[model samples]
Target: MGNRTAVIVACALVGLTVSTPAFADSPAPSTYGRASYLLDESTGKAMISKRADKRVPIASLTKIMTAYVVLGQAKLTDKVRITAKDVRYAERGGATTADLRPGDRLTVKELLYGLMLPSGADAAHALARTYGPGVDGFTAKMNATAKAMGLSNTSYVNADGLPARGGDGYSTARDQARLAAAALRNPTFRSVTSTKSRTVASTADHRAYSWTNTNRMLDAPGSLGVKTGYTRAAGFNLAFAADRKGRRLVGVILGETDSSRRFDTARSLLKWAAKHPVEGNG
Candidate 1:
């Protein structure tokens, strides 16, 4: 073919290939639950959502706020000597513990590991007690922190998120997402939750105990560290994140029937989000 004819032929072939459409992108799926929201961290877009603003008990997911308070107020190197009070709080309400004892000592960083990994109510109280003038004072800090973070629907009664005297602790899916996003801002907070396993030194005897993360999403493919919650009142709740195909997404599922399905539903939601980008839903 002449040079001009050959160039025209090549251009026509390129146009034909470019004009043909590639496979259509899959659609994101809907899910069941009273309230939920999935957000793309990059674009501030909600991919899926259902009643995300309705207030509900958040269970231990409240610790995301607790983590923010402690990390913000205390320094890692500050020494926390476990008190009789600390031991009492740690052993309170039959919650899982790092077995802290009276007079045992660790840095603030170490206590945070116990606080987040096992959702230890005791460690949370201890940090609050030491950092605040008293427990009530610490709770005031938690509430104040919530307001500062624009969590209009959040209120905290205790540092550990164990059941309260009058009733359940309250927060909305949107409020919890705000807490999770705030927690993500601190490099230290990210370090604590993302960890699958950690060894916490017993304050009383200096023995080390291994505590595993309760959020099963950590085991899920592409799962990142966040938080988990459960109680008879809260059912099963979770806030999670994952990076797939260079797009990072955050998901929150509350009121799931059981622990396993909470993880399953979260995995399903994330998968759907990856395939389908829906604004103002999550």
Candidate 2:
């Protein structure tokens, strides 16, 4: 493992603790996200909080729960036949997609790449229908999974995060940071989210598909895995994590108004954490 990886592992050996945003010197610059949070894994302190608890539409970030529920209930090797219904759902929603076509037989693992890296609404449908009694059952599991994880503010009406006419899933930065922390605890979820790109061959027929991760923060230094989101209702959102100097940090930014700004804010969050270095407890 690289030196940085070693530091992260070591930092994790001690329990997580969060210090107040008391900086060693000057406070970090004002941030931009409607809800922004920073968790300093070394001290376990919430080093930054800007409306971290205000509930708002969460967009595709709901997929983290979708992934968690599926991973808990399905085997990665299980073969799931893609269906016309799934593709059709994707067509109507205007969601980001990995070009999943009907009749492509993909494994659960392959579908996860579709579900996460490209944020495929079709892949979400496939996993939900295959694992749950139906899409409704699967979405119930998503909410149940959220509650079980202590995500009180989170709700899910769809496996993908397309808002229902009356309901778009809403979660606070605190709840999402909690969700991301839980997802990272699952090795498979962590590995998949951190991967920048993947090419998986359909086990049933051998057709291949490739996907790239949606979180641009993954390209930044010390960046790790997590997830991203966007919608007319949710604006641009991102849940991001990183490892630098053996410490792990989790950041969440919701409702950033646009795509590029979400990334710019996320990078700024990390830089702010690095420079501020929370110090002096009350």
Taking the candidates one at a time, how many backbone clashes does each contain?
Answer: 7, 8
Writing each residue's lDDT as its tens digit, candidate 1 over 201-236 gives 675675787888988888766677798888888888
**Against the true structure, candidate 1 has what lDDT?**
0.75
lDDT of each: 0.75, 0.79
- Candidate 1 deviant stretches above 4 angstroms: 1-27, 277-282
How high is the lDDT of residue 132 in model 1? 74
Weakest 10 consecutive residues, lDDT, candidate 1? 14-23
- Best candidate according to lDDT: 2
Instruction: Check candidate 2 and list the clashing pairs.
Output: 7-246, 8-246, 17-43, 17-44, 17-45, 18-44, 18-45, 19-45
